[model samples]
Target: MPCELCNAFENEKSRIIYSDAHVFVVPILHPIKDGHVMIIPIRHAENMKDLTAEEARAFMTAANLAMDAVKKEYGVTPMFLVNGWEYRSQPHLHAHVLPSKTNLRGLYAASEGVVGKIEASVEELTITADRIRVHFSYES
Candidate 1:
């Protein structure tokens, strides 16, 4: 099976809120909080260290844009998270952008179905994506 990120890119799904040449931002399906998103490199790199300088720059730019969008839409400062290759479910390089004060423990439990996480429905995802997209200004 293709990587989920790759599939999202290929399908041009509603989950994608922003994209430039090097990176794209998508609302996380199982969000740690409302307005949680992810910045994913266009290329399939397993780790940040694997990214080229240009790719790194693009990722940072996109991440910043995502933070700004989340802040504007959700009225909260955003926190970014990265997992090393060993901890990643997908080998593709991506960084998470979440609202500050998000309960990380809740997010973990939600992922495992031990507790309910805010899983955006398709319509809700589309609205959230549009909310962020309108605030995203960095396009190259």
Candidate 2:
């Protein structure tokens, strides 16, 4: 079976906000905050080490663009995070960009001991995606 993120890249249900040839940005199905988004490469790669130079460049560009969109749409600078291999929920490489006023340590502590998924409804995802999309300068 394909990785879930790979499936999401192809699935309309993913609520994609922005996408280019190399990467795509989508609202997290289980967001830490209102504007949390994930920057994922089109090609499957376990981590940064696995990414080719082109892929790395694309990922960084996508991350920066997504962060800018989040900031413009939410009026808050997003926190960029990447879980280490041991903590990752999926094997695919993805960067989390979350709009939060809290510091990293506070965010990490709050996330700890949290059980069960806080899945977002399709409606909520759609609305959030639309909001971020409005601020995205790229055509997708």
Candidate 3:
């Protein structure tokens, strides 16, 4: 099955926070808070469990770096998570990074008609990716 994330990843409008030969980080479309990021392998995998050891390491490293960048920008570490359903979502592997000081509830709420909420949709993701891109100016 085609994964929605794969389509999102290809969306140039999506916020691409960071990208290297092996991995890329983008903002979450439905962010829990202001600085929600997602990390994925440039070479898609079905799920985290299926990632090769090297791929796993690379993804984690990118996630950590993204987290640091979010902290630097937002003054909060934001919550982080990863989810995969073997039979659903194409089993693609991805990690979620959210920046918030209060409860994580802020991260999962719907974006409609909300104030001070950050949604990681294509447009918003692009803006956020640009913000994070500024911090990681030192490229590979």
The local lDDT score (0 to 100) that residue 140 gets in candidate 1 is 61
lDDT of 3 by residue, 1-140 (tens): 66676676577434576676677887766665667677887776766778778888788888888888888877876667786334123356778777868444444565445555553456666677777777765433
Model 2 clash pairs?
A: none
lDDT of each: 0.79, 0.81, 0.69
lDDT of 3 at 30: 62
Best by TM-score: 2
> What TM-scores do the predictions have?
0.81, 0.84, 0.72
lDDT of 3 at 1: 63
Ranking by lDDT: 2, 1, 3
Top-lDDT structure, candidate number: 2
Instruction: Report the candidate with higher TM-score, 1 versus 2.
Output: 2
Per-residue accuracy of model 2 over 97-126 as CA lDDT, tens digit each:
988683333343566778865677889789
Q: What's the CA RMSD for each of the models?
A: 3.2, 3.6, 4.9
Candidate 3 structure, TM-score to reference: 0.72
Can you rank all candidates by TM-score, best first?
A: 2, 1, 3
